[model samples]
Target: MHPLDALDAAAHLAATDPAAAISSLPWLSASLADDAAAGRFARWGRSSVIDENVGAAVLPRPLFDELHARAGLEAAWPVGNAGLLHVYGYLLSTTPTPYGLKRERWLTGDLERACGLAVAALLPWIGAETLLSRATSAASALLARPDALTEEAEGRTARIALGAPLPDGTAALAYAVDGLIVTMFPVADPAAVRAGLGAPRLRWNAA
Candidate 1:
């Protein structure tokens, strides 16, 4: 199973069925737990950080760690990976549109900052490709700039072909693009996804 398999499944499902996406949360969280325990993702237990000082109620890390431990953990949204997941989860579930794309909101400063940690912790070692995938460059860019994300020319987030690597050296990008897809939501097309994501197309070695 890919580290991000659960997330990708939810993304595609949200494209059509958000109820299905919400219903799948327990299963998704369980699958995510397995993946984490498998060591692809280190234990994502609660962090000491808190974002309550601001108006945004980030899912508390302790609660996230608890609910995250099993498929059963549920709580108010605080600021952490679970908060990111929860925001997307609600948007994906309640929307009538595919992926709730047009409805997606840009994350607040603290939440966006939290994603910086998630992206770094989640990104895997990708191999060089003859022509690198969009994610490689995007990942490089997101690390440098959190507010800027991959968007299509029309300016909606697009899925940038990031997923499980082929296990061969040419596997391309990894956990990055998939994370952004649902975390960010749709723009217009894939090409713009790469462009709005910020970062000039650099050679794999250069990236």
Candidate 2:
């Protein structure tokens, strides 16, 4: 099945059965428990690493380990190579923040710094397309709303795409856009859906 079609199916499940939707993600299926995933996302909504001085995002270590394992990366990537910083940056950018902390802080502070560092470190080995795809997929899972195809979501997706070193951001944008479109419009068979939509026009810095 096309990735977007898969996302549509996931979103359809999310409408009535959010747990099923989350569990349907291929990358997340093995290690992450459904209840645990929900709880962890809830913690992300309630907690803040800013006031806590935790140095890392409030996400649990085991969850982070699972994400890395799914990505086929070494454990040392998170701590030694600053992969956690990249994860934190993606989360801060895509996920909603608590009221007290300024979104600007996350946008301008360690979030951007960490993302840049992550791009520099990972791009050489993984290439930009894979890096952005995995990062965005992980972020989409963390947000627990893979169906959010809003302008803001698209913008966040664009930021992630632009962070990579791809020769052209077109494919990256298409992947993100297609994911959003599928989530927003969950049809069992996407051939008709894709025919209706024509093709997703690259909306983010296609140049």
Best by lDDT: 1
Question: For candidate 1, what is the TM-score?
Answer: 0.27
TM-score of each: 0.27, 0.24
Q: In order, how many clashes per candidate? A: 14, 0
Alpha-carbon local distance difference test for all models = 0.32, 0.32
* lDDT by residue for model 1 (1-207), tens: 553455456555654554455356554444444444444222122221232223232333333444334433433434333322433233332223333321133221222222333322222211221001222233444334433434343332233343222223121121232233222222233344445646433211110
Instruction: Indicate the residue-level lDDT of 53 in model 2.
Output: 27
Backbone collision tally, model 1: 14
Query: What is residue 124's positional error in candidate 2, in angstroms?
Result: 20
lDDT, candidate 2, 24-137, per-residue tens: 655334323332333332221111222222333433344445444443444442331122223222222222334222223222223223233342332211233332333444
Off by over 4 Å in 1: 1-33, 43-66, 71-77, 82-92, 95-98, 101-188, 198-207
